[model samples]
Target chain A: MKFFINKENLLFAIQSVQRAVSQKSPLPILTGIKFSCEEDKLVLSATDFEISVRCAVPATVEESGSLVIPARYITEFARRLPDSIIEFEAGPDSTMAVIRYGDSEFNINGYDASEFPSFVIPEEEFSFKLDADLFKEIIKQVTFAVSTEESRPVFTGVFFEIVAGRLTIVATDTFRLALRHTAINEETPELINVIVPGKTLNELARTADPKSIVEVIIGKTHAAFITGEIQIIARLIPGKFPSYRQVIPNQFISEIKIPLKDFLESAERVALLAGENNLLVSLYIRENHVVLNMRSETGWIREEIKSEVNGDKLEISFNVRYLCDVLRSINYEQLVVRFTGPLTPALIIPEDNKDYLSILVPARLSRE
Target chain B: MKFFINKENLLFAIQSVQRAVSQKSPLPILTGIKFSCEEDKLVLSATDFEISVRCAVPATVEESGSLVIPARYITEFARRLPDSIIEFEAGPDSTMAVIRYGDSEFNINGYDASEFPSFVIPEEEFSFKLDADLFKEIIKQVTFAVSTEESRPVFTGVFFEIVAGRLTIVATDTFRLALRHTAINEETPELINVIVPGKTLNELARTADPKSIVEVIIGKTHAAFITGEIQIIARLIPGKFPSYRQVIPNQFISEIKIPLKDFLESAERVALLAGENNLLVSLYIRENHVVLNMRSETGWIREEIKSEVNGDKLEISFNVRYLCDVLRSINYEQLVVRFTGPLTPALIIPEDNKDYLSILVPARLSRE
Candidate 1:
């Protein structure tokens, strides 16, 4: 294969596909990026069995051929090449590939392109285009709560549910759950439910441009996200996700409003004194003031912030890290803490918006 | 003990001393920072047996007392506290310390002050003052060559040799050596040779301001650096250092000048294709052009650049990483590579200065 392309354009395409390359794989071919020059474009594809990324760059195709080269070496070489056009040509016997840029030439050993696994791209059947910025925001607000533990594979992904014109994203790790609601511009369709791995979603969020619209196509076993000239296909986790709506508290006997930044700062301060593995938080409500206390045999910290309380004074304890994560993921100016008795899980939501809610299970406080 | 001080000032002092704190130490007291509050100053000190740092912050001390608090907790707390005046008060029994800032209060369990190790500062000793920026620059340039292997404890640090009117710093890892030369204003009757730990020097570099002047005091067993209100003392490694001067070649048969950035970029590009862990570089010099070839059974990369060569055509091979490090550390625009033969060690120096040189031993090339 022989082709000439801009260094930056080729580098970007290689990097976009490199995210799916696996360092530890049974097949050595999986460690390479397949490069094919056909017609008028150069195509780059990388996969690790579970997910695959393919991107095409405009190029002057001198001859149409294919070869698989080491992903990391090519990526680094392309990145360091001076701003100039890069040329690639297959060597004799197709055992080596030569890359030339400016006065520099890199001859890298190549793997048989026939050994590379082929991934089929799902046809654009039921597709929806959404604003990349808004989609990224929704993912950021809910992906952090996804469970990383692989024991329950279903919980390791975010549950996407679409009914009528509204779309909801929910993630739960048993200790805490995050739910975000949004509206889609597409017409009402049959209810759709799928669990997409949080890691793949995060990569998509990073690669997607905030200003561009991302086209998403869902299939039986995989989902495809097309942004600009890049396309990413991720396999759906096949399992049953827990019903998170049932766990959210529907009633609250006590509620308090506190500034978001103030609460976040105080939580971070108190968390420093807590143990590394687990952090305990004790909340005491008295009159119009709320006292947040965290203590360990190592140290103790107390923060008192004035809040608008509208119920009987109560005291509750929970994991401080869970509360902190929820507060940090939120972009609201003020947050409301709704409690349903001392032992029930508490709900945290933006004071002005009810579209997003975070539920934290309270810890059993020992009698002092 | 009771005192109040600006949060920013206290945080800075705590951060400086915390650099000496080690999480994994046999002595528990080494992990805690000793606080001594007297009259109008609060002193914070931390030591890891090998190195110690102490700094004093201006404060309104109500009474005089001292205690040891966990360094990590205090540093983290101070970093997160709001920008305001912080109040510090020790318990009547002196077993707990209270830190208050705005509406937040932290009560950290304290250790007995008597358990904290005491460090003595040398009086009426040899002292020299130098620009912090220049000292830091010299350290940055040579310290990267320090031996990380613990087999030779003395080689794990940089040797600082001070003569009548000059200061020379040298570091080597057996494979490569870097030397930096700088002039000192004061003349001394006695020559000084001290080997300071690379880790400690790195910490000192981080805390030292580039624009300020730093006072250096060399003692019998320890070296002290004073900058602003902070004093850092490091225990010298006592042993005979390798004769680095004898290893550097005094004469060479061939010398080539090349742009530092171009050489670095080309070396890095070829090195990426070299085998992991073992990076070998082969240089082929012609009448006016130099070609660098590096290949592993796994990959192959070759780059050619034009240069001005002074001797007959020569070929040499060496560890690519060593050359890359030296080229990266050079601050000059251009560098000259001087060598005796293909197997002999090569010297890399700034094109305009001969005082600073990096010597790299050649590596045996594998048969193709």
Candidate 2:
């Protein structure tokens, strides 16, 4: 393909699609980025058979053609090029392309465009639009709880449930769960649910433009996220997601309200004494204060913070990492934590917002 | 021991001495930092058998004693503590210490201070003081050429030669050499030469305070760098450093001056196409311009930058990484490169500075 484009534009387009390039595929062409130059724009596409990304940038086209270039070389070359117009022209065989800027040029070998795998998004059954920032926030709130264990494939993704105009997203790793609720602009005729791989959700969040709107389309086996000039298609995880609603406790024997910053900082300090792998810390819920305690082979730490507590006093232990994750994810001045018993999971929510919550299961205190 | 110190002061003291704690030493006590509370100051010391560091901070000391605490725990605890006066007290047996701040406390287990390795700086044979910023800058300019190959232990250190008031430092891996010279205020009566381990120099640079003066003392078997409230003592490498003066050519047949920005950028871009391990790139010096070329298995790249060439046409090849290192390290607007022949080494010097220079041996061109 023959085209001329600004260096910054080319760099941005490559970055958006580079993550989808296969690292160690048996088919070499799968490791390349397919470049297609049309009348007024150049489109770049890459896929690893699991997720595909496509990005387009405006350019001056001299001829309409296509080629698949090695991702690494093109990326580094584009990053080092001067901030000026870059001229790209393919040879007659279309296997070699020359990139020129000022007096410098790079003759790069590429693969035949016909050999690249075609990326096709299946027909969508439900579609809706959401603000890109809101979508990113929703992903951030839930994806951390997604299970990294591959044995239970269904738990490795974030569950998305849509009923009417409200969208509920949840992720659980059997021990902890994160749930968030938001309202999308579009309403669907019927209830729609899908499980998206957590990795794809993270990539989508990273590439989402805060000022733009994201169109999310869900199909039987695939889902697509289209933003301003980029589109990401991810394969939906096929399996029945566990019912997370049953995991959250509805009643609590003790409820405590504490300043978010004080509680988070205390937990972080007490966690320093926790075992590296177990990360277990005990919390004693009293009438006027909460005490956090952890013991390692070398030492033990105890931290106490003031809190407004009600009901019977209780002591519970948890993997402090989970507590820290939810504590950092929520942006609030204070948090309300509810506990049914020492062994039951605890519910933590922002005091001012009811649409978001996180549940963490308590671990058995080893010292006891 | 009992003392009270501000959280920030304790954190700074821990940071300065933590680097000397051994990660996997045979003596477990070496992995801990020795804290000594005396009169009105708390001193922290740590050693890994090769290097030792000590830092002191002001504190309100009620009792005078010492203990060795694990480095990792103290570092993390200090980082998480509130920004207020922290109370520290040792138990009766001195095997454990309690750190209290606000209503929180940490009981940390530690070793007996008697078991800790004592760090001692021997009587200095010669000493001199240099500006901390200038010393750090000199280290940075020469340390990059230090050999990483453990087989050649002598080359793994930077050679320091002091004659009169002039101090010269040289480091080389046999393929490239970086040399720098500066004059110190204090001159010794006799010539003093020593080879300091590159790793020690790097740590010294990292810990040096820019606004303070660094007093460098050379003893029989050790060297000490003292700046502000921190002191680092390192064992000198025992070996005869090679005479590097012969490696640098006395004269050159071809000298070309080029803008540092253009030359550096072109080399960086061309280096992308060079072999991953060899990093080979060819430079063709013409009458008015220089062309940089590199060929990979997949493709080739060529870049031409204008230059002021006063020598006959010549072609030479070099490992682009060495070129890029000196280019990035030197702060200059233009560089004068002198070449003796296609197979000899080349000299690169900043246009405005004469106290620093780099010698890079050329590689054989594979294509020709």
Candidate 3:
């Protein structure tokens, strides 16, 4: 293979695909990124069994061929090259590749391209296009609530459910749940339910550009997203997601509207005095004020903030970290909090929009 | 104790002293900062046995007393407080401290002030005032070469030697040495030698302001530096530092001058192609040009840069990381490299000044 490309373009393509490359894999070929040169473009691909990334860049190709090179070494070399045109050529023995930029040349050892695994995408699947910015925002809003513990594999992913014209993404780790809903332009009669790993969604969110348009294709066992010159394919987690609708409380005995910034600041302060391991925080709501109390073996802290309270006064306890995560994820000025009882789950929503909701389970109170 | 102070001023003072506090110390008092409230000033002190920092801020004192509060918690609390005057008072039993800023209040459990270790700065045996920027520059130029290994405790510190009107600082780890010298105004009859820990010096360098003068007081066992409202005292590392002057070659058989930026960039590129471990780079100096070579199991990289080489042509090999460190530390336009032989240490100095020098020991050739 022989091709010439700009340094910055080649570096960006390599980095986009490098996220899926595995450093240590049972299959040695997985550590190499397959490079293919065609008539007018060069494509780079890397996969680690669960996810794969492929990127194509415009290039001047003198010969069409394929070669697989070590991912880390080539990436580092390409990144350090001067901002000039880089030329890559495969040797006749197919055991070495030469990279030349400016007056420098790098002879990198290559692995057999035939040993690389072939990844295929289904031709017929549920496909739709969405704004990259919205998709990335949805992932960021819900992915943080996914469970890191692998004991419950289904809970380690975000649940994506689409019905009619509205699409909702939800993630829950039992302690807290984040749900974001948006209306799509496409009309689909089929009900789509799939659990995508939180980690893969996070990577997509980071790589996707904010103002770009992205096309998403979902199949029986895998999902793919195409953004600009990059295509990302991730294996879907095969399991039945729990029914979260039943857990969301429909009615509340008390509701309060508080400034989001003020509440977040007060919670962070009280968290400093919370328990080291449990990080428990107690909320005492009375009339038009809410008091946050935290106690640890070392000390205790109490902070109060004024709010617009309605219904009966009540008290609830929760993990301070869980609440902080929800507050940080929501970019809203005012938030409405609804409480059912002392032990029931509390729901928080943005005052201007009801499409997003955060649910938190109350901590068991310790008798003193 | 009772006092009120500006939140910003108190936060700055607390942050400066908190640098000396470590949470993993065996002595519990080391994790707390002593707060002494006098008639017009509030002094905060924290120590980790080896180093201590104390800073004072002006405050309105209703009563005079002292207490020790947990460092981490207090710092975090003060940083997040509202932008207003903060009021602090000790409880009647002297076991708890109350802090109030704006509408927020934090009550923290306190330790007895008597339990805190006393950091005493005796009448200075040798006192001198120096330009903070110049002192900071000297520290930055040489401190990176200090040994990180704990086997040789003395090598982990920088040797600060003062003779007549010259101040010299040297750091080495056997394989490489970085030396920087400057002229002071005072001419002392007695020579002074002290080894200060690299960690402490780095912290001092960061905290010192570049626009002001810093008063340095050296005692028999400690070195105290007062910059603005902050004072730092660190115990000296008592041991014999190696005589690095003997290792520097006095007579050079070959010399080469190269642009610093070009040399550093080329070295970085060559380093990327070196092996993951045991990276050795070879430099071949000819009559009119220099070539950098690195060959590893994975690949090989060769880069040539034109330079004005004098004397006999020579080839030498050294660890790439060492050369990169020295090249990065020097902020000069051109650097002159001197060498006696292939095995002798190579000296690198600024083309315009003789006050700084970096020496690198050659690596043994592999028998493969």
Candidate 4:
């Protein structure tokens, strides 16, 4: 099989599909990215059972066929190939591929494409479409809270559901939880709930352009996200996601509205004295200011930031990293933090935006 | 001890001296940075036995004294402190340092200053001065060829020698060598030869400003580099340095000039197919162009680059990384390479510069 393609387009397609290729996969075929040239298009694909991605780029095809080449070699070759159209051809045995650009040529080994596993979107799956930017942003807001541990597989994914009429996504690692939803303007008659692995959402958000609309399809055990000419199909995380709403506090004794920038900088400075590996920082709320106190065996640092306060004064301690993550993800100038007590979970929200909410558990630091 | 110092100046001093603080030193005192506060200046210092750095920043001392504080905490506090002057004070036991900036304060633990070991400059040492930029540049050109293995301590250092009144520096891993020297115009009445460890030169280059002339003092076992208010004294590597000039060919049978940019780009691309650990690439020199051929069990890549050839067609193989290193380190448009058959070493030199020269030993490819 022979085809000539633009160097930039080929590299883009190879990188997009190679994201799903597992470099350390036990199966040799899983390390290969399948390349198929048909008529006027070249389709590149890779899968590791958990997730599969396929991207098709326009190319001139004098002879059309398919082969599976090592993902690492193909990416490196495309990266180093001269800035020009490249003549790529595969031998009849589908074991060797040659790439020529300018006067440079690379002959790389590959495997027969017949043995490669491919994912197919279920015909009976339910389908819905959302603006790519909206989907990517929502994923970014919630995915950071997902558990990275594999033992608790359900918490390792972001829970997706149709709550009321809006599409909602929620993630939690037991200690902290994040929930973000699209505008309630869109109506959905059918109730849909699926837990997608956080990795799949991150990969999709990283590759897909935020301008276009993305079509999403869900089945019993798999989900597919389609954007433009690229499609990503991932296995739905098994097991039931926890009911996080119950854990989030419904009432708060005190609410303080602080400038996000001021609070973020003060928190960062104070957290430096909280020791390595530990990010414990205390928040003391008063009438006109909130004090951040962090200490370890080596030192203690306290910083105060002015804010608008309501209700009784309270004090709470939390992992400073969690608060920093929430503050950095949102672009709001002001943030409202509500505290029920020193031990209970605190709720943080953007003052101008109501769609995003984060709950952080208080840490227990010994005063002794 | 108590003092008030500019936060930026103190931070710079701490950062510069902290490089010599050993994070994994068996002796706990070596991990601490010694701070001596006089009437008008505060001296901060750290040492790892192999190398020591002392830097002084202007400070107003309310009480004159000295103490040793943990390097990590001091650097961190200084980094996060406000931009204004910082009020610093040590407790009566000289074991705790307190720093206050604006409304924020940090209390850090430390050790007694009397117990900390500090290096004293020898009065009998000989001193010399050299342009910092020229010395830093010469170190950069030759240090990359130094052997990193501690087994051969001398090979892991760049030999500084006075050859025919010129300051010559040489380094080699035995397989290859790089020698760089200043113009042979400056006359040195006293002959000096010393070997400085690669790490010491690297740290000095990284921290020392290249604009000033550096004062270098050579003692029996230590060499001190004094630039501005910062001084770095390192234990010189002691052993016989191999005569590298003998290995460098004085005469060549053939010479070829190639565009550095073109040759560098082609070498990097072809080296991609040279396997993970081995970066050997063969250069086939003909009348008009040099073809780079690199191969592994999985694949092979051949790239051709045009050059002005004065030699007959010859084929030689060498580690492409060595060639790339020389090409990237020097900002030369054209480089002249002299080859004596395939087995002997090849000399690479910048067309317009006589200050740098690098030699590469040919690799024995299996096809031999």
Candidate 5:
């Protein structure tokens, strides 16, 4: 393979696909990135049997061929190279590629191209398109609640469902749940559902451009997200997702509307005294104000933030980290929190945007 | 103890002394900071036996008392507090201090101040003063070469020797050595020599202000550095430091002058191909040009840089990391490297400065 590629373009392509490169695999070939050169573009692909990524960049090709280079060396070398035209060439019979720039050259040994596992998009049963910005927002709002415990594999993935031109995403870790609904461009009479690993959604959020449109294709055993010149295909996590709707309460005994920024600041300050082993912070809601209290072996702190509170006065205890996460994720100025009782789950939603809501299970307080 | 202090002032005092606070100590009092309220100021002190720090901040003292507060809690709380007057009070017999600000309050438990270790500056045999900026610069230029091996305890400290009106600092790990000389404001008939641990010098460098004057008092077993409102006392590393002057070569067979930036960049790039086990990069000097070459199991790369070379043509190899450290520490556009032979130590110094120089031992090549 022979091609003269711009340093920035090559680096971008490598970074986009190299996230899928296996760090330590039994098959050594999976640790490399496959590089293919055509008449007008250079393609890079990497996969670890879970998620596969492909990215194409414009290049001036002299000879068309393919090679698999070690991801570790090439990534570091590309970052340190000067921002000039890079000359790359490798004979069809040779497994080593020579990269030259200015007065320096690197001859990096690689595996045979035929040994690399090729990734081909499977036949899609359904496809839908959405704004890249909306897709990123949806992932950010719900992925944080995905369970990290691998024993329950179904909870480790985010659920995606499209029904009647509206798309809904949900993620839960048994203790808390997040749900977001947005209007999608595609209309499907039947329900389309898929469970994608949380890791895939995070990578997509990082690589997707907000100005472009993203097309999602769902296959029987895999799913693909295509945006501009990049495509990410991930294996579908096979399992039945828990029913998330039944956990969200529809009624409340207390509803408190507070300024998001002030509430977040107060919670953070109170959390300082909440010992790491037991991150419990109690919220006492009154007529027009709410107070946060936390006690640890070393100290106890109390912070008060004025807000509009309604319904019966009550006190609820929760893991302060869960409250902080929801406050930081939303951009609204005010938030409404609904509480049913001390033992029931509390629902929190942005005051201006009702489509996104999160539920947190109250912690059982051992002491008053 | 009762006092009202500015948030910024309290934070600065905490940060300055917190470096000496013990993370985990058998003596529980050492894990806390001693706060002493005087008529006009509040004094904060922390010690870990090896190093002690004291800083005084102006405060409105309502009463005179003392207590030991946990460093971990107070430091984090101080950073997050808003910029306002903080009210602090504790009964003479109570072990808990109540800190109040706005509508927030923190009641932190602590130990009696009587249990904390007291640090007292000893009588100095000799003392000298220098610009804090210059002291920081000298520490940075020499501390990088200090040995980290605990077996050789003497090499883990930087040597400080002041003779007449010149101060010279030297650090070496036996493999490489860095020496710097600068003029101080004080002159004494007898030389003052001491070795300070690298860890202490690094902390001193970080806390010293550029606009202040630092007075260094050398006691028999301890050294004290006083700058503005902060004072750091460190136990001197007792041992005879190895004589460093004999390793420097006065004459050389070849002298090469190269642009510092270009030489540094080339060395870093060539070092990428040098295996981590053997960081050997060979420099081939011929007339007015130098070539950097490295060969590893995976690849080999060579880079050429134009410069002003004199004397006999030769090739020498050295660990690129050692060369890069000296190049990065000095602020000079051009550097002159003197080489006696392929195996002899190479001397590198700023082309325009004579007060700073570094020597690197050549690495023996095992194969061609």
Candidate 6:
């Protein structure tokens, strides 16, 4: 596009959009960033069929024009350019452009923007305002439990359920489930449910500013998030999300409280002794303390850490990786482990945070 | 055997030796770290046939004994263990050991020390002392030019020449050469030349203390460096190193001085457009400015930067990677570029320093 802007401003805009550029797209144009110039601003966008991102920066537009430049070259070039005014002029042909800064000038090749697909967000009838930090935290806690395999599309997404002035997000790969709920002020006409791909949520969590207010718009098949200077849209994973409410246990035979950091540190070391693939570790609930035991062909490690225990004594074995993930995603000091039985799933929650919870199914201890 | 050692001290000793642990050793004992406890100190060592490293740390030893534990497991376990006095007690048999710290304990399996090879350094008839920082700096400047391919064993190591009161290190892959020399006061019985493997030099550079005096001992089949609390001995690559004195021309047809950072920044951008495999770029050295041009199947980029020229104009092309490496490794503000011809090699040296030099051969330019 024919525009003159600051090097830093252009670089920031390009980086925000280039995150969605596809490295192995079937169509080569999708690997480029479409640049458009209007009267006083320039817009940049990139898409990979599933997720699209766009950002606009203030620039002096000489003439309204558009072009699609290779994202990699443009980003690297702009980043390396000295901090000064950068001039971009679209060439007469569809395959060339000129960039000038100080005494340095480059005639770069580009594709016509006419061949690029439109990334305009359609008008949506339903939308809600949410805190960026809270949304990011919910995504962090739930995204880890989403199934990585694509065979079951529903499990590959984080389930979103909103009703009665509260929002709850759930994700599971059948072995473990993470559920987090937070109170919101938005009024809904009815209960709303949607399945967002884990990839999109992760990107949103990365790009969103902690203190910024994000407006989430849900359309027929697509969802758009409008943050500070960027807009990200992604197509929803089409399928019915699993009902995880029934998977959580309602009663517990024993509940023990342990320091979160201590427990996570011990489990991490114990997992190392559990071999590489099978991360099995046993937890024994005693009257005064709790013990973590891990064994493999290499050796066995037993860690006894002081804890506050109540209710019936029990012993359970689980994949220590799940427990570590839950602990890392939390910012609380103490974690309560609620056990239903040795064979069933256990509920783990932050001692001071009632809105967050995780359920991990115990694995059968193997005899070596 | 039993001993109580601080976790941090034990961790450091294990890490220093683990660098030589062989991942693909034919004998499994070579993959373990041999621990020898006697009197009031513990020694840890590992060897991979080509290189051997050992370090000792002070500890209270109740009984004198030795054991070889898997390097990977012991290092990782000690790193995760809480920072405290850790008690280690060998089982009745060499195959089992118990480690306790705080309330955590681990029963680990290990191999007997009898299977480990001896890494004792023989009495050296000749030795020289050098500053660790100076030695490390010399290695950093010249080692990048070492040939990575094992087909040419001679080029895979850095050529070390000691004569009179000077030490010169040279490395080259034939395309480009990096040579650096420094003055030392160590009295040598006679002039000596040896080739030290690049891997060994790199490890030595990383582990050597910057402020300590390093004692270098040259043996018939190996070279040993003793610094601080660590001793590293590496087998030398046997072969006649190519004479690079003839490659460094004494006279130059033209010499151009340029601001190192400014030149590097512009060249980096031009290199990005040179594509993946061939990073070819041409520098047009005019009377007042230098123009860098890069062309590939994807596109072409041109950048012109100002410079101080003192001779006839010339145009030369080179693989920008070699030039970039020299610039990044140097801390000098001004760089003097000496040119012989468009086809011959060029010399680059720090403007204020005479002990460092690099010669880069020009490449055939590809016309757009």
- For residues A203-315, write the lDDT of model 2, one tens digit per residue: 99988989899999999999999998999999999999998887889999999999999999998887777666558888999879999988888888889999999998999
Candidate 1 structure quality by residue, lDDT tens digits, A1-368: 99999987798889889989978888888889999889989999999977899999899999999999988778887888888888999997775888887677888887888888886877544667789998898888988899999999999998888788778899999989999998887754688888888999989998898998888787878889888888889888999889887898888899999899988888888778678644778999878778899878887888998889988789998888888888888899988999999888989999999799998888886544
Candidate order by DockQ, decreasing, is: 2, 1, 6, 3, 5, 4
User: Candidate 5, residues B1-368: lDDT per residue as tens digits?
Assistant: 89999999999999999999998999888999999899889999999988999999999999889899999889988998878899988845658889998888898998899878887886888888888998888889888888999899899999999998888999999888999999877787898889988899999998899999989998989899999999999999999999888889998999999999888877877767766676888889988899988888877778788889999999998888887777777767999999989999999888999999999899887576
Clashing pairs in 5: none
* Alpha-carbon shift of residue A20 in model 6 (angstroms): 1.0
Candidate 2 wrong stretches, greater than 4 Å:
B276-278
Give the C-alpha miss distance for residue A8 in model 5, angstroms: 2.4
- The candidate maximizing DockQ is 2
User: Scoring each candidate complex against the real one, what DockQ results?
Assistant: 0.74, 0.78, 0.66, 0.58, 0.65, 0.71
Clash-forming residue pairs, model 6: none
The DockQ-based CAPRI class assigned to model 6 is medium
Error of 4 at B274 (Å): 3.2
Q: Between candidates 4 and 6, which one is better according to DockQ?
A: 6
* Better-scoring candidate (TM-score), 1 or 6: 6
Candidate 5 chain B TM? Answer: 0.95
Q: After superposition, how far is residue A89 of candidate 1 from its true place, in Å?
A: 1.9
Docking tier of model 3: it is medium
The better candidate by lDDT, 1 or 2, is 2
Error (Å) of candidate 2 at residue B242 is 0.8
Two-way DockQ contest, 1 vs 3, winner: 1
Local accuracy of candidate 3 as per-residue lDDT tens digits, B124-145: 7777778998878888889878
